[model samples]
Structure formats: structure tokens, C-alpha cells
Target: MCNEGCLIADLELTFTVKGSHEGSQKILLDSDPSLRIIVFHCVINEQTRLDVTLPEELADGNETVKSGVLSFPLNSLPVQKEIIVEEEAGVVNKYNNRKIIANLSGDLDVRLGFNLCMEEQEFLRKRKKYVAAALKKILHLEEDLKEHEVPVVAITTTGGGTRSLTAMYGSLLGLQKLNLLDCISYIGGLSGTTWTMANLYEDANWSQKYLEDAIKEARKQVTKSKICCFSLDCLKYYYEDLKERTKEGHNTSFIDLWGLVIESMLHDKKDEHRLSDQRQTVDNGQNPLPIYVAINLKSGYSAQAFREWLEFTPYEVGLLKYGASIRAEHFGSEFFMGRLVKRLSETRICYMQGMWSSIFSIDVMYVWNLAADSEDFWCRWTRDRVTDIAEEPFLSMNPYEVDTCLFTPSSVLSSALRDVLTGRPTIAQYPNFIRGFQMHSKYLESEGFSTWKDTVIDSFPNKLMETADDELSLVDTGFFINTSYPPLLRSKREVDVILHLNYSGGSQTLPLDQIAKYISGQGIPFPKIEISEEDRENLKECYVFEDADSPQAPTVLFFPLVNDTFKKYKAPGVERTPEEMAEGKVDVSTILSPFTTREVCFSEENFDKLVKLTDYNVLNNEKLIIRALRLAVARRKQRKY
Candidate 1:
């Protein structure tokens, strides 16, 4: 959407390319692609535009520093510049028919300026190598490693690096160099988790594409007079089309009906006029649209406190820029149970399908559980609470992001379909193919599962909680959280499995002999159970203390038996270092520090089994249990009858 005589702003953008190439360090282009490059030259409130280039520096054959900084002049004047690099065409193929269009828009003309250097020639020669290695690492880690499978890869802080737009440029360049661009797909998930539509990052065209797709669908539905259809015939066709279009459609899909509503409103000219009029009514600035946050009460953040924490966060302002409003929901003390019941009850009212319904409901429950389960979390550390409780409606808080858990329109659609088709109540549920955790560990140990599978093992120490009158003592014997007493006991009986749960910090108090005896009790175990002198030394390093400096290692607590009486270790009166706050250079709020245990507590076998047997009973509804049992019986009969 461009206008005539618009002042195109000439801005120097710098970012690093995170990929590699085989030879020479020149900026590479794709073989066959539509180049939609829009370089603008504009004057924002009398700001002067200057053209400049920075020299890049190389270190040990690697490009380490980018040169040239753009300094805008203080004077305000009508500036005229020449179109310098328009005719610089690349090696073209007749079959490709790629055209680079030079269009003058608004008050600015745009052109490219390239500065090549020979210093990084050697590095450039092996650029593709580095890129390929990095990508290979990423892929290998994703597919093989069960512990560190990356669910999301966020590209940020681009312009400041030696290779500007390094990650994005590198990914695209890598694809071209390897001739894999056509083979792989770039999937975009659009989120409307915010209160309003206008407040969003426009850097990625994916969001726009999601919107465009929605518009196309809404237009088709409107044209066919199928918008009013309640038979779900349109929905059925839409899902089938989605499955064919997406690779992950077999197990995942998402839909944003709220987005459709917005499209329909825009389709109506009257609503469009009202929207324009509302925009003009902003005297100071645009008011923030409302946002809804649902959390479990166990996160230790009261509804009021969480609001304050949000106010203190950087995204608080950023979210406002995108027409967002915030509200918090504390789902009482029973996180999983409350969520399971709520979603099951409210599914019909929200007009949601499988993924959308599951994600929206489950995230509220899961995130809340995570928060409640974290330590020393102060929810009200920042500002005054603007709104209280679960005040905002779910429809208003349409799109949102909690940490890395993104719920977008596309993802919602996929998830909904997967949920319905798979007969799964929650996306987090695992199958009971594993007997307790034994079968699960075997599955993980297989070469086919990937590296993350190794994360399923539980080697950490468990902490046992005691009553107030009980003396505080650490025993080598694993114990339970006082609150988890009934559930743990119930689970032990139902599954015939002993539970090991606690915080590792308290493991130090347990004597070595006691630990050895406990391990000896684990029948058919290896000699590693016999703690030697060297083992004691190693165990000391692994034990809990405030001075623990295992880089990126999350403090873990476990319980073998469920109990309610657990000791809460308060963070000593010391400020956390900057390094402590950033989870691999990502700044998460201190309030969420405890739940940041990145490591899975149980072995994969244990977790999967626990999820299958315990999570369903603990995390789902009784009806789900009945349905699951019936399904199992039916499958058995199918094999027998």
C-alpha cells in the first residue's frame, strides 16, 4: 500500500548473515526468485538522509566487524539524489525471467550501494562451509537430541552484526547455494494474541501473508454465501485443503476465526469508515487494546502482581504500540484440573475446533502451571495492576505469546485438526506404549528418536519436604513434596511405580552411605549406584548451594513421593548478574526465573509414561479416561474379534 509523492526514507540497515557459502565472501543472490526489495528515502519530520558505507573487518579469516555508520544531517531541506545502482544486473538465466523493477514512490527514490572487500576473501571462500555446518548442527540437534529440540528459532538484533540480516540472509543464501530452496518450505504462524490488529511487528511478511490468506478465505466464503453455514461443510473442506497444503497437517493445524471476523468487518465499508474515524480520534496517541492472560494460581503471582510485572517488562510498551491491552487470569490452585474442566465445558461457547480450542485452553493451564511451579517468583514487582482477575474476554485477547509458546492463526488451525483427528484431548498428552517409564526409555534410546531423547533420564537428586514441627534434615532417601502426598500415593498404587521428586540443592544433606543404600535398593541396577570417594567429590559439585556456577544449568528439584510439606528456598539478598537473567542472551522476567528449569525432570521413558498414565488422570477429565479406556477396548476387540 503505497501513495504518490510519498517521501521514501533512505535508511542504512545493517545485520549479520548467519549462514555460509562454499567460496568467496561476496553477498550472494538466489538463482530464481522474485526480488521485492523496497529501499525507501524519506524525511520523517525534517530528518536529513545521508548515504554512507561502512568497511567490514575480518578476524582470522572470519568477518568480525561491519564498517560504515549513517549519520543524518541536522538541516531540513528538499534533498535530491541520483538513482545510482539501478542498472547493476546480475548473471541472468533466460529461463528464469527475473525482473528487478525500479519504481519511484512518494517523496523518495531508492537505489542499492554495494561495497566489496578482498580482506575477507578466504573467509568468504569457506562461508558456505560455516553456514552449512551451523544449519547441519541445528537440524541434527532438532531431530536427534531429545533434550534440546528447538521448538522456535527467533531471529533478532540483526542490523548491528558484521553480516547484516545475518540469520535471514544466511538461511536464504544457504538454500540457494545448496539448491534446496525449492525442496524446503518456509512456514509462517501468525498470532493475534494481542488485543488489536494494528499493533504487530511488520518486519516479516509472514504476518501479512497470513492476513492475506485469511482475506482470501473470507472472500471465498462470502462470495459463496457459505459464511452462515453451521453444518461445518465449509470447515471440513477448509481443513482438507489445509492438510494438502501443509506438511505437518497430519498432526497439527490452527485457525483464527477472530481474524476472519476482522476481515468480515473490513469487508463491510461501514465498519471500515468507523475504524478510520476511530483512528483519527486519537488526540495524544492510539490507546492500547486489551490483552488477556490466564495463569494457574500455583505460579505464586496474584492477578494484581502479574499485571505489575507486565508493566515492568519491555514488551509492555512494545505491545501497546501494536494496539494491545493486558489482563491476567489466575486459575486458582488446581492448575491442570481447573484447565481441563474449563476447556471441556467452554469449548462450545468459544466456537473453536480441535487445535484452536486445545491451544487456547491448554496454554492457559500449562503456562499457569509452569508459573506456579517456579520458585521465588514475585508477580507484583513492577507497577500497579491496571485490571484485575480474568476480566477480558477470550475473543478480545485474540493473539498472544507467552515466552516462546506462540498461538497464531495458522498454528491454531493445524492444532485443531490434529486434536480432533488424533482423538487427543491435549497436545501435551503422550501415548502409553511405554510400560510406566521403562518402555519410554527404550523408545528414546533408539537411534531414530534424536538427541533430545537423552533428556528423559532422571539423574538429579530429589528433595523431601517436612512439616513445620519436623526437624529439617537431608536424607539420601528420595521423598515427595508435601502437597503431592495424596496424588503420589495414588499414582504409586495405580501404576506400581516409586516416585523420585525434589530439589537437587537439598541432596547434599543426605549422607553418602544412605544414598548408596538407597541406590542398592534399586534392584538390577549397575555399580554406578555404589558411590565411591571420587563419586562423592563429583556429587558435591552437583549438590545445591547458592554459589553453584554450572553455566546454563538449571537448578532442579525432584520428588519420589508426593507430599505437601516442601521447603521453599528464598533467593538470598543478592542481585542476579546480567548473565543470570538472560536465558542464552534472551531476557526473561525474574518473576519467571524459577520455572526456567530448562531440563526435563524425568527420563523420557518416565515422562511419557507419566503423561500417559498419570497426566491423563491428573491433568485430564474423568470422561477422557472413560473414552480412552473404551478406545483401547475397541482396539483390542478389533484385533481379537
Candidate 2:
């Protein structure tokens, strides 16, 4: 069958003729096994006539063989000519005017095929126009990006709740162009739920670079005079963790110092229903001890440099007890918070799967498992709260209150800091907090910087290809587990096997029903079967039973059947037969019966059965389908580069 969204054409044909004398004549032709015959009607020129002579006695004691004369329509053409027949060469001719040759030789034969001659011409005309339009838009966008001074104009995406590995691979390629691998550093922690969440902050390096670029761009506008982004929102995660821990009156070992400072500012307005304990305290006069070493921004921290500092932090002591020394270095501050036995007892227990819930991020609020059922929990987790430090200015101002308050350079820093500090550094008004933000945003927009939504949605496909590798091998399977189901298929952590049947080959309907029957025979558990009506109709065209044929594609199989015309018919018998007319016989002509039958299975065993019985002509078809399936599975399992 022709592929969907495609065009097909037939360019040549061969016919065979047989005869003994003036009164005997017959015709035959070669056929292709790959294609199943769908139609046999043809227009014959009026010039040729065929007359048959009957032998005195027939083999079955009947003299009916070739006893009559047959001729094509007369007076339908401008001229008429005598019939010419070639017996040895299997060629047939009409007055030697038209060409004829022996038919194709094969056991699984196809006498006719559908041609898409007109459709092909139309497709070429339209495809050219589509390519031209898409090219113009892409070129225009590329030029706009180049004009802007955007050093790292990357498209970012998230997988599960973590940043997508595809984006990272693309970024690496871009950086490689400039040979900046050494100069640039990637930082971030990955959560197990990277495949389940699409949250950026939970990515191992979400705040590592992209966030750095964004925060720096914002800061440059805030400073007007030009300030390189020296540090990222390293404390952002800590602050989020703190808010959750401080609810209890006592400091939970899990409360990182930075989180505590941010949480303390919310002392006046207590909400018990909130995720964190709603305990209010006075000045708390007790100085919050640093759980981990606070690094000076001046000393840049690289993966190598961090190892040296980890040697000194008191946080390392706790990791030694748990025999997770390497991991302690990974968490650093979080490990510091985990050290206090008192804090662990007071902190609320929460279970989070996927990357987002475990990671700290000021940018992304939170992420939940696709299987997560608690709406209340999900809603509370994602509510965007700027940091708690900005809520109460007076309390945040005291150096002892919190070492630093992370305020947007626009509001809190310019207005509140200016009034609080007796004498601040003399700086240019160019970086007037709020105004700078507007200038930066306007500059980016004027340069045609697209929103994150557009970049990821539009360029995601291209970026994803960057992570693809041909070396990977994938598993091919059917009957995907539906994660939408609750309690059973939804939260299932294991993979289940399935059967896939083909519907593109001959006698398709019969094969499908046969497989379905086999499935029911075995008490194998499966999801409710959903059969498509369009597929049922297409099955009539498949004819594989005669040659034990099947579409090579695992999804399409065919079976063939024999008929008196030497033509083939295949398809499952229908439950209802058509009504007979006064002649007492149903007209087969109007039924448009199947040329073949095809069947589908949702079980692996059924798939094997189809494979074993597949028509030999298209031996490689199933392999092709298997390859495509494997590729898809490989894509799903690939990790970020």
C-alpha cells in the first residue's frame, strides 16, 4: 500500500497470451509478490476478438471448456485489426499493433496496484513553497540574535523537573565554537526526578550558568555602570529550605543558616497552615551559627577549588558518621544543616520524588511527580514567594539579623539600603535600580530576544537532536503503560510487555480477529483494548493468507485468499452478510471485498506468530519497524550529556 501523505505511480506493465488455433485463445501475466492485487477491471480496445473451440470430450465428461466465442466491444474505435497471439513467449497482440509480454513470475502475485501520478505532481509543487517560507523565518531570527551582544543565547528546557540534558548538550557545542570550556564552569545538582519534572531550578546546574547569565544581565542594568555577575543566587535554595524548617520552635538540624534568616523575617505573621511550623519568636537573640563555610565571592570556586574548602567545614564531620563523605561535599550547606540532631527532630518530614522537590531554587517554586495525587501538597509547594527577607525590612537590616538580604537591585537595595546605611559608596545614577531593569528589558526586547516559553517550545526539537547518538540501541515494545490511570497503571514503576499486530497486509481483518482470539484464550492481563474503525476498513484491502503474507512493519500484517478469477481475496468474514436480490445471490461486485486480511496483537507471542508466518517477499519489513521502535525507546532512556 502507498504510504500516507505520499504519492505513488506505475510506469510499465507486461501481459501474456495463449492460443492453439483460430478458435482457441487465453491470456496470463507475471505478478509481483510485494504488492497485493486490488482491482482487475481494464478497458479493452475494440479491434481484437477471441473465439474458443471446444474439444469433443472434456476431462470431467463435460464439453463446456472454450465452447463459445468471445469478442471485445465493436465499433468503439476509429479502426479495427485482427488478433495476434504468441504462445511460446506468452505474448498477446491485437493485429500486431500493441505490445504484450509475459507476466512477472512469483507465487505471491499482485496483478494490479493504485497509482498516485496526479498526487505526486501536486505534492512537489506544495513542498517547495513550505520549505521557502520556513527558511525565511529561521534566517531572520538568526540574524537578529547575532546583532544583540548576547554572549550565550541558548535555548533552555527541563526534563521531568530538572533542566533537560538536551539543552546542556547544545550549550556545550556552542561553547566549543569559542573554546570557552575552561573559562566557563557548570554548577548545579541533579535530582532523581530529572525524567519526571521539567523544573529548571532542580537541574544539577540550573543556577550554574543560565541563571547566572540572567541574574547578571539584571544586575548590569541595576548597576548601570556595568558590574560583572560575580555570584549567582547560591543562597536561594538555602532560603527555601529554611522557610520549611523554621516552623518548629527549635532549629531543626536541617535548617541551613541562610534559610533561617529568611524565615525569621516572617515572625510577625504566623500561619500554622503553612508548610513550615508557625512558631513566632522575639529577636530570637540567639545568633544563627553557620552550618557550612561561607565562601568569599572574590575567590572563585571551581569543582577543584571546592574540594579544598570541603576539607575544613565542620559539616564534613557529620558526613563521616553516615559514611557519605563524598555526598557531604556535594550538599555542603545542606549537610551542615543536617548535622544538628535537635533540628532533625523539629523539622517536618516530607517525601519528594523527581528532581524539583529536593533541590533549592528561587526561580522555580517546586515540581511534583506526574503520579503525585495530592493537589493540596502540589499547590502549596509551587506558590511563588520572593524571599522572606524582603517581607520585614527593619528586622533584615541588623547585620546580626542576617548576613545578607537578597533583594532585587531595583527596590530593596536602592531605596531601603540607601536609607539604612549611613554612608554608602558613591556610584553613578545610571544604575538606578528600577530604571536599569526597564533599560535591560527594553534592550533585550528590541534586539528580539524571545521569551523562554518560545525558545523552548520552538527550538526544543532542534536542540534535542544535539544529544542524539546513533550508537545507542533501544528496546522495541507496544502497549505503553498509561500513567493517567490512578492506583494501578498510573503509579506503576515496572514495565509490562505487549503484543502488536499488523493491519497493512492481506486478509488483515481475519488475522486481527485470530490474534484477538488467541489473546483471550490466554488469561494474560492487559489494559482495555481500543480498536480503531479506520483500521478496520483498511484491513479489507490486505490479502496475505494465500501466500501467508504480512506487512514487514510489525504494525501491519496481511493474509491472502484465492478466487475463481485467479485474483485473490482476503479479509475476516463479517458477522452480517449482505441481502440477496431476486436472483438469489449477493452481488460480490458491490461489496468491494478484501484483497487480503491483516491482524494486530497486543502480545509478544502473537507478534512472533505473525513474524513466523510473514510472506517471504517482504522479509525485511518487520525488521524496519523494529528498528524504528528501538530508536524511540533509546531516545527515552538517553541521559543528559
Give the best candidate by TM-score: 1
lDDT of 1: 0.22
Models 1 onward score TM values of 0.17, 0.15
Clashes of each: 101, 58
Residues 1-641, candidate 1, lDDT per residue (tens digit)? 11111111222223121110111122123322222232332213333333323234423344353344333331332233323222123211221222222232332111111111121122223332332333345333333222111111111110101011111222222223333222111111111111122222111232212233432332232233222321244345445543443442122222223222222322331121211122222211111111121111112333222211011010111011111111111110111101211111111111111221232322322322343353211122111224422345542342453322222233454455435433423321111111011123343233223211111122211111101111111100111111111111111111111111121222322422343343234221212323356644433211211112321111111111111111111112333356543212211113332212221122333222222221111121223222322332223234321
Q: Give the per-residue lDDT of model 2 (tens digit) for 1-641.
A: 10001011121222111210112222221334333222111112344322222223323334332222223232232222323322222122211232212121222111111121232223323332332233224323243211111111111111111111212332333223322221111111122112111122223333224333433322222222111110113233334444454453323221123122222211112212211121111012111001111111111322222211111111121111011222112221211111211112322212111111212221121112121334443333332234566367765665556555444433332232223222321110100001001112233232122211121222333321222211111000001110111101111111111112122223324433543343233222223333468655532322221111211111222212111111111111212223311211211122342111111001233222222222221222323323332332333234232
- The whole-model C-alpha lDDT of candidate 2 against the native structure comes to 0.22
Residue 285 in candidate 1 has what lDDT? 16
Please list the Cα RMSD from the true structure of every candidate, rounded to 1 decimal place: 31.3, 40.0
Badly placed stretches (over 4 Å) of model 1 are 1-230, 236-289, 292-641
RMSD of 2: 40.0
Question: Model 2 Cα displacement at 481 (Å)?
Answer: 31
